[model samples]
Target chain A: MDLTLKIWRQASSKVKGQFVNYQVQNISAEASFLEMLDILNESLVAKGEEPVAFDHDCREGICGACSLYINGRPHGPDRGITTCQMHMRNFKHGETIIIEPWRAKPFPVIKDLMVDRSSFDEIIQAGGFVSVRTGGIPDANSIPIPRRNAELAMDAAACIGCGACVAACKNASAMLFVSAKVSQFALLPQGRIEAQERVQRMVAKMDELGFGNCTNTYACEAECPKEISVSNIARMNREFLSAKLISHKEF
Target chain B: MGKSLTYSSITKKIIMSLAGLFLISFLLVHLGINLLILFDNTYESFNTAAHFMATNPLIQTFQWVLFIGFIIHIIYGIIVQLQNWSARPVRYMKKGYSELSFFSKFMIHTGVVVFIFLIIHFANFFIVAKFGHVDEVTYKSGTYENLGAVVVETFKIGWYVAFYVVALLLLGFHLEHGIQSAFQSLGINHWRYTPVIKRIGTLLSILITLGFIAIPLVIYFS
Candidate 1:
């Protein structure tokens, strides 16, 4: 397949970026989107030109490293898969593929198609964990968690920390991501101990980082590669409200 | 602990949801009261209801509450919308092709239309009944401002009725998304009940729109 790629190009975070078109010919339809980019980069490097830069790790898709907005979707035209998992066959023979980075205030573009997502780290650091005293791995049966709760927790835990929710959201809201992180614990017994504090701190951090508010658009759910449900957001809202109202926690 | 709840994004949505829900309730009552006009050509039942609403202290107090709800809903909607606009400083050259819910995306636009309609609606009825001189009608119970007559007369105009119909339909669209979205924001989402809530929201929006539209069409025709 021959494809025309309109990839965003930028030198640094402080510089302006614009779409630069390049044509890649004789490409296999089975090539993953990232591999296609690699082919383009190899030719660029051969010509002594700078290759388009993007973020990727664990090309198998669980690492949440590859963030590419292809053809107006967070992970190209494919559904429920990362950019690395999206194969070239999803496109036509001579399709004009537009690729860009996640555009959000928190995720600033570092270079072509690569945006810094340390803001996610800061949000997680705010309180995305339980501060359990280290001990021998406890027997799984000790908690006596219901099967429904565990399944729900695992579902929320499926988030790979990708910024597709924010990128797909019209408001660039991180509600879906933060809510998934919050629900991963709020649904379980062990994580319930610090649930109040976790929701408040993480929400405050998300708000402080200049992420937009969720307006229930559900675009995040639609674009999520992990197929994370928006129900977690409602759960987070419930948790946050209870934390602020019932719990006697200070700022 | 020191953070204000008002500043939190979730809390802001909670506020919007609470206010929106209150307004939605008000619409049901408003529709009921307006439906009285269609009962008879004499318009006595509607006039009495309007007079009671205008004079009853509790209803008057609730009116203020309703007004405040509208004010908060509008103000917070604009604030959150502006913040959302600024969140993504850069625009993608290609528009998204995701199958997002169409009504949810244009809420602010539909809301603005409803707000503009409210101003025109207020000028036609509220201001006239409250401050401006409106003709009075006498009933067996008492005499009061004949607001029903104003409604009937207003709807008699072809263009005004057209505008009213259009505005109500837009309001319906707003309510369709707003109702379910409000429930979701209030943390009422559940697998067992969310689908039901969404259906109820759509049904209620349609009923309200059609109910309100009936008045103008009936008044104009009769």
Candidate 2:
């Protein structure tokens, strides 16, 4: 299928960017979205033009490396899947696709489609962990966790640090991301020891990082490739409130 | 965080919700009082109720607090919207974020309209009742500055009544999103309670709006 692409291009972070148009002919419908981009890049390289740079690793959606805002969606039109998982079959032949980078203030553009998502790493590093030094990876059976608790922990743990939540959000809020980490820790016995400190530090770091506040638009939950619940946000709010009320410690 | 509510986004949200909930609760009380007009022979009851509210000590204290609540809610709303606006200085080229309702996008627009409506409303009723000239009318019982008559006189203008009804509908729209959202923002949300809360919120918003609108309709038609 032939397709027209209007892709945002910039030389670097300091330079201005514009939507540059390109056409790729006779692309296979079975090709993944990234693969389509790969095909486009191959042609661009062959023609002695600069290849359109984008971020993709593993290409299987787990890595969360492929971040592209396709046709105004974080991961294209397909729900519950990353850009790499989306197929060209979802698009009609001769359709024009406009691709842009994730446009959050924190997640600055590194290149064409690659954004500096190190802000997420900083936020996670702020408080998203159990600080205790467990000597070994010992018996999981020793800790009697209820099935419901285990399930909820795993659900919160599903966040891949993809900035799509921020991208999809009108305010570019990272509440979903922060809440996922908060809920993951708060729900577990091992991580609950420092719950007060964890919730406080992470929220402070999130605020300091210039990420927008959640207004409960639920767009993040809708556009989430992992289908992370916004309920995690509510859970985080509870944790934050409880922590602030109970502890005299300041961050 | 410099011990300021504005410094923390969560606290700002919590404050917004608390003020919203206060305003929401007040709407119901106001609705109940306004609903008195629907009765054929309760004009004195309506004025007496209004007089009681105006003259009572506790209700008088609450009236000041209610004004403060409205002030805070509006101010915080502007602050949040401005912050949200600056956070995304670059707008999206394509329009595809229809995932959320128009309510989310146009909160400010609806809010500004409600504010305008509020100014006109307060000017028409609140100022007149408090400091403006009001005629003392005797309706077979006693002569008091008939607050009910003042209300009825205002509703007599056809377009004014129309504007009042339309503004109440907008208030309903605002409350529809505000009620459940305020609960969620204050960390009162749960998977079990959220759906139920949203339903109650919607129903309450519609009921209060209709209640207020019903008064204008009855007064205008009569």
Candidate 3:
């Protein structure tokens, strides 16, 4: 299949960026979206032109490294899949695909179709973990967690720290990502000790990072590659509220 | 703890949610009283209910609380929406499609329309009742401010009734999203119960929209 790509091009973060159109011919329908870009890049490099730059790792889709806003979606039009997993067959031949980087104040564009997502690292560093030191790997049965709680925690734990939620959200809110991280720990016995502190510190950092607030639009959940539930956000809200109103911790 | 409730995004939403819930409850009471107008052409019962609502000491106190609820809902709405707009300084070239509900996506727009309607509503009724004078209606018990007559007069205008119906429908749209959303913000969401809450939200929106619109239409056509 042949395709026309309207790609955003930027030399660096310091300069202005605009959409640059390029045409790729004789592409296979089964090729991954990233591979299609690779074909474009190979031709560009052969002609002594700079190739389009994007983030990709673990092309199987779990690394959360591939970030591309294709045709206005976070990871192309396919549901529950990252850009790397998106195949060319989703589009018709001669279709023009618009590709751009995640546009958020916190996740700034680094170059053509590549963004700086280190702000997520900053939020996770705030308090997204249990502080207690476990001597070694404990027996799986030792935790004595309920089946429901284990299932819910595992669901929340599936978050790969992709900024797609931020990109898809009308407000650019990180609540889904933050809430998933908070729920993954808060639902477990081992992570319960620091639940109060974890929610507070992480929320404070999220607010400080200038991420927008959730308006309950559920767009984040719709566009999530992992299909993470927004219910985790409600859990985080409950945790934050309880911690603020009832916790014995000193202000 | 260091974060202020006014400054924090989550806390601000909590405030907005609580205020919205309070306003929703207030509408229920207002709707019940407005429904009384349908019972009598002379407007005796409705006027008496209105007089009692205006004069009752506890209701008067709660009225102040209602105002605070409105103020909080509006102020925080503006603050959060501005922050949201600034979060995406550059607009997307292609608008994305999602399965997100239509009501959820346009809360700010619906809210602004309701606000404009509120200004007109207040001028027509609240200010007239509080600061201006209305003719008195006499019951066997005593004489009181004829608030029902004021409503009747306002509803009698064809364009005004049309405007009222339009505004109420938009308010209903706001409530459709606002009711379920407020519960989510307050951490009341669960897969087991969220569907139920959404149903109730839709039911309440229909009830309020039709209930409020009924009085004006009945009055206008009667």
List all candidate RMSDs to the true structure.
Answer: 1.7, 1.8, 1.7
Candidate 3 deviation (Cα RMSD): 1.7
Error of 2 at B83 (Å): 1.3
Sort by TM-score, best first.
1, 3, 2
TM-score of each prediction: 0.97, 0.96, 0.97
Residue-by-residue lDDT tens digits, candidate 2, A1-251: 99999999988899988899999999899999999999999999999998999999988889988889999999999999999999999999999999999987888888777889998999889889988665888676897788888898899898888888999988888999999999998998888898889988998888888788777888999999999988888888888888888978966
What does DockQ come to for candidate 3? 0.77
Clashes of each: 3, 0, 0
Which pairs, if any, clash in model 2?
Answer: none
Off by over 4 Å in 3: B1-6
For DockQ, the strongest prediction is 1
- Tens-place lDDT per residue, model 1, A80-182, is 9999999999999888989989989999999888999999999999999989788899985987989999999999999999899999998899999999999
What is residue A52's positional error in candidate 1, in angstroms? Answer: 0.3
Q: On residues B1-222, what C-alpha lDDT tens digit does candidate 2 reach at each position?
A: 245544567777888889999997788788778878668464777886787888899999999999999998998888788777776666667755647645665667778889999999999999999999887766566666778778887889999999998888888888888888888788887778888999999899889888888888987887
Worst-scoring 10-residue span by lDDT in model 1 chain A: A242-251
Off by over 4 Å in 2: B1-5, B139-142
- Can you write out model 3's per-residue Cα lDDT over A1-251, one digit (the tens) per residue? 98999999999999999999999999999999999999999999999999999999999989999988888899999999999999998999999999989988998888888889999999999999878665878787987999899999999999998899999998999999999999999999988998998898899899888899999989889899999999999999999999989888722
Candidate 1, B16-62: lDDT as tens digits:
99999999889999999999988867788888888788889999999
Q: Report the alpha-carbon TM-score of model 1 versus the true structure.
A: 0.97
